[model samples]
Target: MSLLIVGATGTLGRQIARRALDEGHQVRCLVRSSKRAAFLKEWGAQLVPGDLCDPASLPPALEGVTAIIDAATARPTDSLSIRQVDWQGKVALIQAAKAAGVERFIFLSILDAEKYPQVPLMEIKRCTELFLAESGLNYTILRPCGFMQGLIGQYAVPILDKQAVWVTQQSAPIAYMDTQDVAKFAVRALSVPETEKNSFPIVGTKAWTAEEIIRLCERLSGQEAKVTRLPMNLLRTARRVARFFQWGWNLADRLAFAEVLATDKPLNASMETVYPVFGLNPEETTTLEAYLQDYFSRILKKLKELDYQATKTKNQKKKTSLRF
Candidate 1:
């Protein structure tokens, strides 16, 4: 059966496409630009040029696809808000998919979306989940926690650069799963018949606090990392200031998320119940330590390259000065 992967150029979407292709499935990718998604073509994906924001662009993308895995996300710079993309765009896609006779629709949602309705992103995800459930189409909602790849860029890089990793007043532990693992589950959902009309909360085996993660980075990099704990009130104040200035992006949403992260709330539901349903072992997921070690090694290699370039430039300048 053929599968259409929305957001095929994104990190998680690419992983899903790769996994599906490896399993010998015919894969079609919905991308805004065929040129940006050219690499997907090399991976044997049929590229369909379309934008999620544009309802008119979706029917052609969904045509003749047996199933769909929607990993598309709204960017901060997009003309539409998260509500528009997650609700309106997704609804449009669902309507088109049903019209195209697509059987299965797998949606990638944020974990605890219902619990954190105050957060705009999660609120929109919850709304989309409801819409998908009532769409009269076969659907599977996979709510995955934050990705380790994102954490590496957000927390690990700052720690590696000898900069402080910031946290709110009450930092909570989060179950950050690898996107590849999430993709694996998504692909399995597409192939597995029993997963239809079900929702699964995907998470890693362990929950990691910001402090614990920072220390792990330090241990892996052999460098001491600093931590900065900001008061909740301060973050709220900063968010207000940003809103007053009409910042380019939504700082309020970001600050709201930061506050959510500060609480000791569980980011995801128990994986124990969902894993067996998917025929997965919780222990199979990547651990924080393993992810950090690999990430720190890459960071070290990059730092060495930068240092070499700087030294070479300095030596060249020294030689030129001596000649003068």
Candidate 2:
């Protein structure tokens, strides 16, 4: 009677695990390395050694598990390929869930995955969604835009460090949600029968373009940002060159995300219909501005503390030397 979380070590997965645990769910984490996932163990999730790439591991992992939160995906840094993990691996997982007779399956997918067949991840996700629908298991597919946590590295850090913040010339606004917010919907899906066999777009209240984010960072950090814009044509050419080699398909697959950003359409979906079902208020979602403000305040305060300590140490050395 445990709620199993696949990809428990991932950014979104970690948040989901925490939310489930906080809400008093019996949590189990399927991970490749239990040692590396010690933090999750510390957070009170039962760790089971399992890998999606190894289909044999699925059956045993699914034993006694009533619900599943599938947040696993083929990351760019993963040793496995998108075809191996995202596509084939997910297929094995779905079949296992159906056989195990899990009560509810919560899948985390991307927004507009069906619209972009050219992107490998998007294409794979769309195919998986169709497969899951036909798998005979009650499922809820949560399609979210981007994660606001990623902006810390993509914009906030580089701006605070006075380094180049790379952006696309044809940038589209994206409504990014905090992973924690998305996690709330995922855990709530288990008890909410209305969410079963349905799909919902879980996104932030407002859509923000890259330019607006850069300006916000500049204002918050009080630092002039070094912005570098990559032309869409150049990005396409880079992707083309990357696809020329068999070994580069992974890189090419990752570059395919550029297509989503290099468009006029916003990467947002209406959440008006979604809020009432999950009993979640729109105001509870974290805004990008507030997220950035809190991050800068904490970071700047730490930086000031470090600077003061360094100056104090230097002054103490000078006094000691003068006396000597």
Task: Compute each candidate's TM-score over C-alphas.
Answer: 0.89, 0.98
- Give one digit per residue, the lDDT tens place, for model 2 in 100-215: 98989999999999889988999999999999999999999999989999999999999988899999988889999989998999999988999999999988989999999999
Q: lDDT per residue, candidate 1, 1-324, as tens digits?
A: 889999888879999999999989999999888888999999999998887789999888777889999999876565555666767788899889888989999999988888877777788889888988998999999988788888877687787787888777686788888888998899999767779999988888788887787778778888887778889889878777766644423546656677678668867567777877788777778887888788888879998999999999999999999999
lDDT of 2 at 251: 77
Off by over 4 Å in 1: 241-251, 301-324
Residue ranges of candidate 2 with Cα displaced over 4 Å: 245-247
Among these predictions, the greatest lDDT belongs to: 2
How many clashes show up in model 2?
0
Error of 1 at 135 (Å): 0.7
Give the clash count for each candidate: 0, 0
Point out the worst 10-residue segment of candidate 1 by lDDT. Answer: 245-254
Candidate 1's C-alpha lDDT? 0.84
